[model samples]
Target: MLSKRVVSCFDVRDGKLVKSVKFVNTKEIGEVVGRARQYYEDGLDELVMYDITASSDHRDIMLETVEAVASEIFIPFSVGGGIRSVEDATDLRWAGAEKINVNTAAVDRPELISEISHAVGAQSTILSIDVLRVPGGPLPSGFEIVTHGGRTHTGIDAIEWAREGERRGAGEIVVNSIDADGTCDGYDVELTRTVVDAVGIPVIASGGAGKPEHLYDVLTEGGADAALVASMVHYGEYTVSELKQYLHERGVKVRMHY
Candidate 1:
């Protein structure tokens, strides 16, 4: 099995790190650059910085903020929000982002995924799918792909979209659960497993990571390559080193903290 990776997420809005429930009622936490620098120094494997409201507001990601955070962190970083075309992806790479994550834009034009992947190697593109479950069993409350920062539903089956994304050349897929986001209960394991089974690419599970044990559960039981965490890490509730230590002790393969 591949070693589980610890990825820290910074949900930026108006150039600040903000935490909110289900993408609403956001409260500012701190500056994005400072927190990103701290995590990079603390041995995080990678960083995911997102302008949470950019797609909803129909604006480009704050390149100035991206450049500032990029200069401070040495690890691989992925930036997303309002990334609509091959040019957008190329500009983000030029601005120092290692990968470009596309959500709303991809949903609006599925072909863009393939176009960006072809323009800038598939490895440089990430398909970020925000999902919500509708209560219905026989269907397993199956995934619904959401866009525009969870404000709009694309009416596409999440699993099918993930499969198509892989076929379209997306190097990776980020499955973010809208219902479980910021709840701190745990990841929606079933939701992750379903997507993982549907696609052959790396699936990074996001949202609802509350504790070290939760991380463990998702990596092992949930079968995810990596997990993206925000609230737990941003609020000082858990440290990257501590979580890695616990995972290592549990016999889960992870980069050991020095």
Candidate 2:
């Protein structure tokens, strides 16, 4: 059986780790490298870092920060934001990222997905989709894709976009709910299930992971391959070991050690 992964997300702004509620009211968490090493030591399955402002500001990813974090973690480390070309992805890979995530740039040029996958192989390419619930719209899934740190709402249907991403050589997709982000309520299981059913690739459900039960719900009922966690792990609410032990006792398959 495939293990359900618990991924820790670092939303970095100005090279410092930060957190936000619905992508607003951002506040610094601390120096990123130390926090990353701490999480790695805590037995996290994987780690993802995002230059939250890179795309909106139209700048390249912070390679220094990426390298810094990558040096400390032994597991898969994925980085995204402001990756506009194949060269950028290559640079990140060289800097130690095991996976390259493409968001706004992929939306702008869908072929960039193919290009990166072709260059690095699909297994190393991840499509990160930020989705918002748009009720009463022409969208079939009632979810719309948002970009540039949830600052721009692209009217594209979430399900169709996920399908397109898979067809274009994206090996994995991270479905993050803009509405559920930082709310600590739960994941948008409906949104996650919609994409999971629409594509053949593995889907990582992101946003709104409050407690262990929420993770269980998304991984089992929602049919997600993994659950991305932030606030719950970030604010001393739970450690990676504690969360894994909770899920393991409840029959959710997860790696139990660092």
Candidate 3:
């Protein structure tokens, strides 16, 4: 069986780690590199760093910050935001990101997904789908895709978009639930399951991981390959090791130690 992964997520704005509820009222958590290094030492399975405002500001990723965080970790690291072209993705790869996440840019130009995947291989490209729930419209699921740091709502169906992203060559999809974001209620299993069932690539459930059970549900019932944790882990309520142990005791497969 494939061992489930526990991913640590950091949302950086102006090079500082911050937390938001429903994608607003942001507050700084700490220095990005320091927090990332701490997570690495605490035995996180992987780390995902996002320049939250890059696309909104129409700028490139913070390579300086990326390099700083990458130098302090020994595990697979992925970075996203403001990746507009193959050249941008290449710069991030050279800066130490094993994978590149494309959201806004890919949404604007779907071909960029294929182009980046072709240049860096599909395994190095990830589709970060930040979505929010909406009333029934074009999508039967009523979940629309949001972009530009959850500020722009694209009338794209989450399920159909996931399938298209897979076809376009996104190696993995991180389905973030804007509705449950930072609420600490739990993951949106239905939202996650929708994408998981629609796509062949690995899906990582993001937004609203409050406890170990939440992670377990997403990985098992939701059919997700991994869970992206933020507030729960960010505020020191639980460590990655403890959460993994909790899941392991409950019969979930996970990496126990470095």
Please name the candidate that would achieve the greatest TM-score relative to the true structure.
2
Displacement of the residue 196 alpha carbon in candidate 2, Å: 1.0
lDDT of model 1, residue 20: 72
**lDDT value, residue 247 of candidate 2:** 92
Q: Each candidate: how many clashes?
A: 0, 0, 0
Reference-based lDDT, each prediction: 0.85, 0.89, 0.87
Ranking by lDDT: 2, 3, 1
For 1-258, candidate 1 gives per-residue lDDT tens digits of 567889988878877888778767889999989888888877798888777764444344477778888899888899887788888788778888999998888888899999999988889789999998866633334678877557887778888889899999999989999888878999989999888888888889998899999889888888999988888888898899888888999999998853
TM-score of each: 0.92, 0.94, 0.93
Better of 1 and 3 by lDDT: 3
Give residue 83's lDDT in candidate 2 (0 to 100): 83
Ranking the candidates on TM-score from highest down gives 2, 3, 1
lDDT of 1: 0.85
Comparing 2 with 3 on lDDT, the higher-scoring candidate is: 2
Give one digit per residue, the lDDT tens place, for model 3 in 133-229: 9975777889998975567888888778888889999999999998888879899999999888888899999998998899999999999999999
Model 1, total clashes: 0
Return the TM-score for candidate 1, rounded to 2 decimals.
0.92
TM-score of 3: 0.93
Q: Looking at model 2, how many pairs of residues clash? A: 0
Superposed on all Cα atoms, model 2 deviates from the true structure by an RMSD in Å of: 1.9
